[model samples]
Target: MQGFKKAFAEQLRLALPSQEVTLERPKDYQKGDLAFPCFKASQSLGMSPQSLASLLASKIKIKDATIEATGPYVNLRLLESVRSRETLASTLGNYPLPPQEKKNATILVEYSSPNIAKLFTIGHVRSTMLGHALANIYAQEGYEVVRLNHLGDWGTQFGTLLAAYELWAKDSNPELEKNFPWAAEYSSESTTPLHRLLQLYIRFHAEEEKNVSLREDARAWFKKLENQDPDARRLWKKFRDLSLIEFNRIYERLGVTFDSLEYGEAFYEDQIPGVLNALDSKGLLKEGENGSKVVDLSEEGFDIPCLIQKGDGTSIYASRDLAAALFRKSKWNYERCLYVAGSEQNFHFQQVFAILSKIDPWFKNKQTHVPFGLIKLPEGKMSTRKGNVIFLEDVLNEARDRIQKIISAKNPELSNQAATSEMLGTGAVIFINAFNDRNTSITFDWNKVLAFEGDTGPYVQYAHARICSIFRRAGGSWSQWAEPRSEDFGRLHFESIELPKSLQGLDHASAQHLIFELNGLEPALKASAISLSPTSLARQLLTISKAFSVFYNDSPILNVEQSEAIRQSRLLLCLATARVINQGLRWLGIFAPTEM
Candidate 1:
């Protein structure tokens, strides 16, 4: 289908050598599959749009398509047989996508930097999934992508946790130790070291209200950690290691991974001195209040300076970020580095990028902050210190439990019910996160995310499953077309069988609309990458699902009254729709189940 569009565009260009041709699909498919508006050309030619359209229509000719002039547009309608064959072949992976210019370049994406002692909350899902989707999209466009997780394993938050641990050790407070034991072993049990650290953290905050000296103690502990105190370093390493064990369990379920696990803030802590020395040598470093080092951005139109260090001689976020940026450029030489953080940190990124630009102008155009809006529950905001948070694992477990009950009621004897329920459950959560624009704040709703109908992940997955069921009812080797050997159901292989020659069964309006929607996958992917948003691709998948529903209702693929050739052709169309939906969902990091 993409090849056909390119051919049509070339034919139009040859007809109007003086103008750049622009093509669009009409709102109503009855007009044409592709339309060329002549308003701009007509103005330059000193003629009416209708007249110019007619002139171009008469001059242009495509091999398997009909060209017509309808008012100010030149519409091209593809021959039904040729359109069916081309569309099916494209969706079945017989056609190759056009070449990409960035095939030789690399992209670095950093995201999901949750703090060490906190649980993975619903608020962190936006950045994690959005960054994952964008990285997938970039790889699809032929760029070498490097996934990074700039962990929040440093700073005063760790100080508070360390202080709390020392203040309430197992020997000092037996009551607190009973609730959360400070054991050396870490496992998948409920009382892991991470959970104990979180409880200790919350208790410290709660007790700080009555004890005014706890804040000072935390600050002092952090200063010790910065000065290479052996005890402080040992505890920090323990917390960091155990946190990764807990975080990786969630990442495993979500099917996410990073290229470099060691390139976090702590990894660049020792490099901070080099950054400060370089800035001081360049005369860019300034002395701010309280002996802290800073960079004045008054000429850059900012009221406040970028703090490079604290008054206590500890390196801060700006200094560490500068070092990370410099290391990425020297190490990976990425063409673009994307930081997927929340919108609230926009100013902090701006300050870091400004400093990079002043130090080296080449860094000006290479970095981007892919900011997303917040996600909240109906009760308002969540806070880690107050212990009013929802863990991601709990939400996923709840979704899986609900799906398991629904499957037991709907398909009592279905095989692999446990695995299918998990797939559908996790896919539902991922789809809802990707369905909206990146910057649109969402109040999480369970009904919308889990609905089997409407614009939901289950709706699209069910469409693929229905197609599989069709093949199952047909019996014999039909199941092999779905790639039964692979764990991923979307790894379809339908090209082994030849499509029926009598494709006149697909001439119906509904079938044509479905084919038209299938043709849009490539363009939709391009648009999603360009805008850095998955909403376009998600909506396109929903449109394909709706179109398939219409086609399924109006046409019969296996009725005895229909001829064998027509049934085979209709079945081929069904397979094509399933394959396209599966591919789109895979790119968004969602799975398409062959059964629901």
Candidate 2:
């Protein structure tokens, strides 16, 4: 397909020597496989679009394609035989897909920065998955990706948790038994540590409403923690350790990893002083309301000043972020650093980037804030302070449980049911999260997320599995047949596929459509990477799956009555489709099961 596209582009260039040529696909596939709009060329050539299109159509000639003028567009359609040959060669050949050249660059992707001692809630899913997918996408396109967690370990929230723990949870006290009875029951369990910490956090906020002094107490505890008070440091470290233990379990299930887990907000505590000194030296630091140290953004068109430190002399998130950015730049020298976070913090990032621009003007272009919308339950938005949140682990577990039941009933004899069900379940969750544009808010629904049909993860996974089943029934594995040139592989080889006469009906149409759809994978990957959105790639996978499904129903790859050449050709097509679905799913951090 790449060769075909390049050849056509070259022909169009030769045809319209005076005009720059760029080809695009028509909105309607029936119009053509590729199109060139003549509006710009017509204007430049002092002719009407229709006249230019018709004139160019007459001049351009392709070896295995037809060129014609449709209204103001010059359209070209490759013959079915040409389409199949080129597409299969591209998809199955040694150098396949992701036609993007080597970037020779590094991308630093920071995501899944769940606060230390907080639950990995569904609210965190959008950033976590979006960042993970972006990292995978960048890596696939040949960028050195550095995955960062950027844990939220140093904040007033931690102060509140510390105060609550000291007040009622550090020991078996009457307050703990009276206020949170279930905490004692779960105290001895391995998972109870983080859960109990969450309860303490929630209790602090709930109690603060009745006790005004609790807020001040929390601030004081945070101040102590900043000053490296031994007790405060010990408690914070204990809570941070427990929270990470719980988080890693979920990350394992989700199949996400980071290059550096040691770098959190707290890790930059010592560097904050240097950041403040630099700001002060540059006259960017100012005394704001309540004696807080700030950077006035009045000239930057921002009404609100960026707070660098609190009135109590403790550093704030902005200051820590400044330090983190500097540390990242000094350490990784990344070509681009992407911060994947929620939309609510758009202003915060703007201010941070603005301040960085003043300090290191070159950095403004290197950093990007990839903001995404929040995930909401049917009732309303989730809140960690109110304990009105759904944990990510719970959602994943529920998906696994529900999918397992369906698999149990549908395929009773299926081996590896447990692993397969888990894969399908998690893949379902991940796919739905990525199915839409990153900035669009999603209302989580059980039915939609777990759906097995119609543009869903399971639908695509099933397509791959069905193809694998075809090879199984043919007494060979897909890996053996799909890549027969491997040293030990021998089943299918690159050969001319003469379709049986019967395939010329609906089967032929669907087969050509499938081949064309597969050709779009490279373009889709490029679009997804450009927009930093996984939605484009997700839609492409679904499109490819649907096309394959039509071909699967319309054609039979193993019918004994058919010629072996026809069967082999169809099987080769199926192999290409399966490989694509497998790679696409894996890139999006979803598993492509050989059996489902």
Estimate TM-scores for all models. Answer: 0.93, 0.93
lDDT of 2 at 431: 93
Q: How far is candidate 2 from the true structure (C-alpha RMSD, Å)?
A: 4.0
- Worst-scoring 10-residue span by lDDT in model 2: 486-495
Every candidate's lDDT: 0.82, 0.82
Q: Per-residue lDDT for 522 in model 1?
A: 74
lDDT of 1 by residue, 238-273 (tens): 999999998898888888878867988898988999
Screening candidate 2 with a backbone cut-off below 3 angstroms (N, C-alpha, C), the clashing residue pairs are: none
Residue-level lDDT tens digits of model 2 in 397-448: 7889998999888987899999999999999889988898888888877777
- Superposed Cα deviation of residue 116, candidate 2 (Å): 1.0
**What's the TM for model 2?**
0.93
